[model samples]
Target chain A: MQCPSDKSKSAMLAYVLKQYGIVIALILICTALSFCSPHFLTWPNLITVTRQISLNGILAVGVTFVLLTGGVDLSLGSLVALTGVVAASFAHPGDYPLIIPVMAGILAGMACGAANGVVITRGRVAPFIVTLGMMTIARGLALVISGGKPVSNMSPSMTRLGGDFLGLPIPVLVLCGISAVSWLFLKNVRLGRYIYAVGGNENAARAAGINVNGVKLLAYTICGAMAGLAGVILAARITTGQPNAGLAYELDAIAAAVIGGTSLSGGIGGVGGTLLGALLMGVINNGLDLLNVSSYYQQIVKGIIIVGAVWLDRKHGK
Target chain B: MIIRSSKHFIGMFLLLLSALIYSGCNRDAAPDKKTATDGSRQLVVGVSLMNLSSEFIVLINKAMLESAKDMGIKLIITDAQRSAEKQVQQIETFIGQKVDAIILNPCEVEASSPAVDTAIAAGIPIINVNSATKSTPTAFVGSSDEESGRIAMEYIVKRLSGTGNILIMQGYMGQAAQIKRDQGADEVLAKNAGIKVLARQTAEWDRAKAMSLMENWIQTFGSKVNAVYAHNDEMAMGALIALENAKLKDKIVVVGVDAIADAVQAVKAGRLDATVFQDAAGQGRTAVKLAVKIAKKEPFEKETFIPFQLVTKENVDKFAR
Candidate 1:
């Protein structure tokens, strides 16, 4: 084993650098931007950006898990809306018992994930196509359930997730906790190794006696669960379960994952890098507002940055 | 073999427990109400809305329903979700249900013409609210986007001393609101050469995108940018966040249309300079009134323009929750 150790060490170093290159670049960009703009480094602005990115970050954690297993989950966005609406239905004033809605939301997301998993595994459908169909169906169900309305008048207990603690949002803390758990799972758990093995080569994993289908199913279910949790936080933040909430959020999650150096090809990436990518995006958005830039050109710039990131990744392949 | 048998048993028990839990939860939840009495002389007014995602539009829908109840009319509302085709289907359904009148917030000014024509051919009176379709209806009731834009521009000019580089955040292109608002802003720009229009782009009424776009604009123009004009409160809120992040909150003036609760709060907090209040609730109520009057064969104006107010910190407290 020691004979080829030197070459492997260099290769591992290269892989690690490739995985975190975008994050390092983003930090550099933020540092330079902060120097250019006096307001960029302020405590209030940093808190605002962190609060804004928390929900997306939490959702991205689950999405990263699925992506690591070489699977895509488009239904995550719709699941968020569905969970939010369902959870809000359980909300009542002075209801200190928040378990009902939280559990309901989690169950709803898990059920949706199970459905996606069953459809893909049992029906022998591609994950992309299956999840895409699930996306439309789930969104329609959300509208049908909510009657094209915003579910408002939520309980204060439910609203506490969006409130501040020591000048930081509770949701941000939740995001950090979720990220920590994801880190531990991906780095140390047997299931995490199985996910990487399955993603790296499904046939090889099956040959090695690993349950490939089961691993993929678990990945999607976890993604769904995380999306549901994100939905609850979103509903609390907005104080409403908007039928149209989380529309196009899948794109943002995918973008964050890709920017964080998660290979679309799978078996690569981690929650830490995804968090950094999401923060980069949040900072850019917040900094732009502070600078008073027009919204139209902002989109073009964001698209260019996304494209540029992928190009950079390809150039420095892991 | 014994260990395998125990694992199977545990799995089966968990499955059974999950099923039981699901059923129990389902039973406890209230059943959806779907029954409605038929054959009454109740006036059914069909409302086809463009979108219900925003708080402003949601407030308008609630107000419309409340006004309809007061006017002794039954409301049948459908959200188009920003799809013209879906709105057309909803209108067809309304016609099938024999609705007495139709109130439409057209997704597109031109694409809604066919549906408006169908409603007209069916002898059902149609009223346009918040926005108008290309095909004229019996009554059009909503704020003048052009006027609102002009008011927003005037405020920006006064704050910037008639000279500054302003960014214009446009809405969905080809839509009535976008067209009129841009026209109004252009008219103001033509008058004041001193006030430069640095850049103009469409945010499509998304806050996150608006914030990102504003950030790039900052990188491009640096400190030359003086103010931002968003088409809606959401975009304005996004722009304000961007400005705050850049430490330009107090120096730059930000204006947006639709005095939504968030925008109102922003104004009160001195984060946003001004926004045009279109009176969404009033618009909804007036549209219902016009629909009822038309159903009753009473005379009403063909085009009813609602008043718009430029709400600033001084007046935002009255509008804020």
Candidate 2:
């Protein structure tokens, strides 16, 4: 009943809405917050918000790869703790160079991620179950390694990772660098394309000569490494490697990815959208704190926004 | 085919769950088996701590272990892991074993009360340590949470000369410590007409969280914040770090409850203005002593209120050791 051009035009519009709607939602929330709180729009406050979201943003980007491959990494929070302890023990005053601790933390995370990948592929277990097991194992490992106490007395250089560099927080700069690189990889690389194909349809991807298992292994390893990096940053910022840190952090990262239009079923999302999602959450939290809103109400408001944003995007997408 | 595979998965899941549950129960039952093997007429006391992850709770646990060894008492200590239900189950296990007494570091005033009731009903004398439950125990040993809050706030008020904007960093919201500390702080604040509370929020008794919250508050309140009162030393340390980073520590007076080793050290170094001492060692030793007294049928005080002391630079040395 409609002309082909008109039909294609409507389809394109729908595609754009589904892809970039979260950005618009984020902008609207920021605009609203600016009207509510004078502090919300200031340069310093903006920098603070970015600094706060940097950890989650790094995590969200890492999980975006896993989500794109139809897998999930629930052990992210535990890995943060485990890697943090490993790094902090190495980072004590004059014990090792800053690179050693940073590398040790990330490598520890990568090893755990590789373990998750092996179990999921070799054992033929579901990602959810495999990751759930790793979650407990990693937490226990962190406790065992740290002796159930926070690791303190970190070197000044290590703690400087949480400070400013060239007028920008180092953590935020790390997030930006990671996001830029990830965006390029996902957009241009063959392995990255295979990630989408595998998640889109496993049998079809296999028929197309893609190494499905390898791609999944890579996805999980990358996620774990990101979690490791986040752990190091958190440890540096807090000036202690607390074994109990990063509780429920995975939930926030996953929420950010989901809010960015990443499907739990996979094969749909990118770094740009994920950054917007993390930014949206950061802005809301900063805004609420600036306005002196009760944390009880802030929790309720956060829940509503997460669900509402996703629901709206899905509805408009159709 | 999907349904059949799902059914297989469910069966496997159940098997794993049962294995986990079995291991957990075995861990709890190991001490009872050890007690039976001893076969000596040694008095046994089972202690259910609120959570051993906290440094303060660990201190209490360490002191309890030491005193129990000295007093020749067989102690079965279990970490409740912040779950009242788990604490109740642990008490029930202790009752089944017919321990001489039970010591409860309650997780909640109401939720943990059920554990007290179950213990008392089984004719077991339960000694509450560190915190309280709604249902009264045979004996209690701890400093008052409210008193610690009052002491810390009163110190801050005095430093500010009774006129300034202050911030309150709470612990885990709705916890016994959080509620009573807020109440005690309010009692002090209400009397001071010039002092005003600029903002209050929970960092969930976490250092990193408090740091982030403090950073945001610094951006929001800036120079207006003259003082900060944290529910615990960990949070106070966090706020102090944030203030130091922002180059505002010298201007702002910071205080916290629980004169933890680090807090005491900080006070001595002049990094922290003050902290209230809850005397974890005192509470732990007293609880063990009282439990032994109840078991031996010796007269003991039903309530032992260990006084909280304010730890400032002047008094830091006395508490540091």
lDDT of 2: 0.89
DockQ of 1: 0.19
After aligning candidate 2 to the native by TM-score, how far in Å is the CA of A233 from where it should be? Answer: 0.4
Candidate 2 residue-wise lDDT, A73-111, digit = tens: 899999998999889999999999999999999999999
- Which residue ranges in model 1 land beyond 4 Å of their true spot? A1-58, A79-184, A201-214, A228-245, A259-318, B1-42, B159-167, B193-202, B210-227, B241-252, B265-273, B313-321
Interface RMSD against the true structure, candidate 1: 6.1
In model 2, where do residues sit more than 4 Å from their true spots? Answer: A1-9, B1-40
Tell me the whole-model lDDT of each prediction, alpha carbons only: 0.80, 0.89
lDDT string, candidate 1, A158-273, tens digits: 87766777766898999999899888888889888788888777889999999888988898898999988988887776666756678778878877887887757778777877
Candidate 2, residue A216: how far the Cα is off, in Å: 1.4
If scored against the real structure, what TM-score would every candidate get? 0.72, 0.93
